[model samples]
Target: MLTNEYLKRVYEGLEKRNANEPEFLQAVREVLESIQPVVEKHPEYEKAGLIERMVEPERIITFRVPWVDDQGKVQVNRGYRVQFNSAIGPYKGGLRFHPSVNQGILKFLGFEQIFKNSLTTLPMGGGKGGSDFDPHGKSDMEVMRFCQSFMTELYRHIGQFVDCPAGDIGVGGREVGYMFGQYKRLTNSFQGGMLTGKGLTFGGSLARTEATGYGLCYFTAEALKCMRNDSFEGKTVVISGSGNVAIYACEKATQLGAKVVTMSDSNGYVYDPNGIDLAYVKDLKEVRRGRIKEYAETHKDATYVADCSKVWTVPCDIALPCATQNEINKESAEALVKGGCTVVCEGANMPSTPEAIEVYLSNGILYGPAKASNAGGVATSGLEMSQNSERLSWSFEEVDAKLKGIMEGIFHASYDASVAAGSEGNLMVGANCAGFLKVAAAMMAQGITY
Candidate 1:
């Protein structure tokens, strides 16, 4: 379906080889479509087979993770680590612990990470790892045992300078703590830099948890100011998901004078017309680990909707989808446009389906792709890596300021790339072109050595 012959051939080969990996296919097709103009402009990319090679991962590791549950029964799970590209530096990504963890999903995440990491202007490459073990409803010991077993094999494949993994999905500070402890036990090395999202007392960077959420707003604010001469002040924002990203985004948006009206979990969504109470959300998700429906029960003015997909239906000036991949479908996207939503920024990996993206572009919505908008988390991890390597620590304000600066730079990079490609203000293509331009150059210069 691509107009460029070289890009089309490369994509077709990938589609044939990865027939079952729809998520990976969807991610690759999006990037391929965006970079076609760049490919035609620079024949060296085709000569170097950059697109073809970039579509394939450098390495994939899978293994069995066996552990004991509270019932005194042994359970088995699958673990995967996809090192998609290391053309820039060591493989760097997150470790997701969810029932949905699979090779295809990790490939999609890792593939996106290549561009995401490049957009940060950091030295880290792209990688992702996770397991099919659900951390929910599991005892601490059970989770610890699974972490140890998963790390028993994963430890050999990762390191401080090789591949450093962070947290995603069900994996967070608790899961990371367990895995880092196991790695230390096995290697007898206190290599704090080997992993990120660590507890603050142990080389973890301050503001890492808030980085992704705050960074998303920073990027959105920059995009709005530059593209529409507007800001987040007095904006009605609708956000999805009740996890760390969503919770922190609610906090930062409120700080910037925007009223975030909605948040959801897998069960459903809660809509608060007066603005979300982030303190309650943080305690509910981060502490009590309760469902989002409780929000309506606590606040009489708010209403709870049983359908999680209906989050986008709430009318607002801006929409931030911080949930899982494809959470917003074509219909949901149309609803946003109809509701007068002028901007859409992703806080999750591939939160919008390709069809949904089409709606955004056609409607002239200010769309910010996940790779560029959500790069704050990984960028802060890079700062953590620097701190660990240098045996130094930075204050929360210092890290937050750096994160803000990096996000502003990312916005300009994408905007400049968009203008250069004759598609000004289209951040979807802007992010892709900006990200691809850097990696494409790196790949061509490095030759086909990967």
Candidate 2:
């Protein structure tokens, strides 16, 4: 490790700036810890003070989103936009619309996006924005009202050449459409590239919906082939969450001849020992927008566990967490290990806590971090940006092929970084260093700016 002195200085500065922001602190610490070797190897980056500026976002905007509820009652919520970096190109990331959205989470997400986007080799920086309002169980009109109010302020900070936001948890096609409509109305311009993950009718890219999940499976398959001497064929996989990432991951896994045994939601998990069929899971989630427990009711052999935390207990060769942040803790990690999980991949941002990560790493499980594994979404988003710029949309096969190439490239990059760092197969360090060095070099080339 490099001098603790430099790490201490950078960490202390971040702590002082974000005194009570645990998410920001956690995100920064993880990236910094992984990139410490890089700092030691590259004195010029240190001379450039790259670490100091990397954590400080270039722009942050907070505003009130006032809308009307279904009952015609006025509702108010806080919204935030954190433009973390722009050294590469325009700011790019997702707009999460969950109740848990906050400045700390957005900052953490945006900061992570910088490296994730960089790892994609795409011309995009990083930014994340969202509101704390929950979109679930809300009527379409209610969501539209909230989206309009949120975009009223957000549109000012975003543009095709500026920051671009896509959909995250709770911000699906419906939310993106509403947000895009509002942006167009406010700006009086048909700025198609201003946001990604748009519906197909309004210039959304083909395969954008399945990019992250499909990309994750692609990366995991590549890792299995290269590192584990294993294949997805005839393997039992357990996946958490039924959202975009989880659902598509399940689909691709099934297509690869893997039987997905278990899938979960925020409520609980459903384990079908006879391998989960993708069509069933998709209908439950995409069509009905219902919970996983519903699957247990219909499938004879499937068992539903109401306690969501126990989802990790199901035995499988592979485990993928596609849920929210910090969903997997040390206990869940132990459960996964005990259940004989050989590989684990993240489909969500920081789904596994530090302790959980330690357990997996110590056990020598092939683990893929969210930034590297789940980068397919943003990579395709970048493709969408290019298509918008060219006013041409690629076919699904073309986009999927490109996405596969990107994921493969990312895995090789991370693997090379690991080998270069003498960490061998430590993908965490590989991903962090690979991403950081790219962005840090870009920042260095930009020179110092106050």
lDDT of 1 by residue, 302-420 (tens): 99999999989999999999999999999999999999999999999999999999999999999999999999999999999999999999999999999999999999999999888
Give the per-residue lDDT of model 2 (tens digit) for 41-67: 777766777788898999999999999
Global fold similarity of model 2 (TM-score)? 0.98
Off by over 4 Å in 1: none
Pairs that collide in candidate 1 are none
Estimate TM-scores for all models: 0.99, 0.98
Tell me the whole-model lDDT of each prediction, alpha carbons only. 0.93, 0.91
lDDT of 1 at 129: 92
Question: Runs in model 2 with CA error above 4 Å?
Answer: 1-3
Least accurate 10 contiguous residues by lDDT in model 2: 1-10
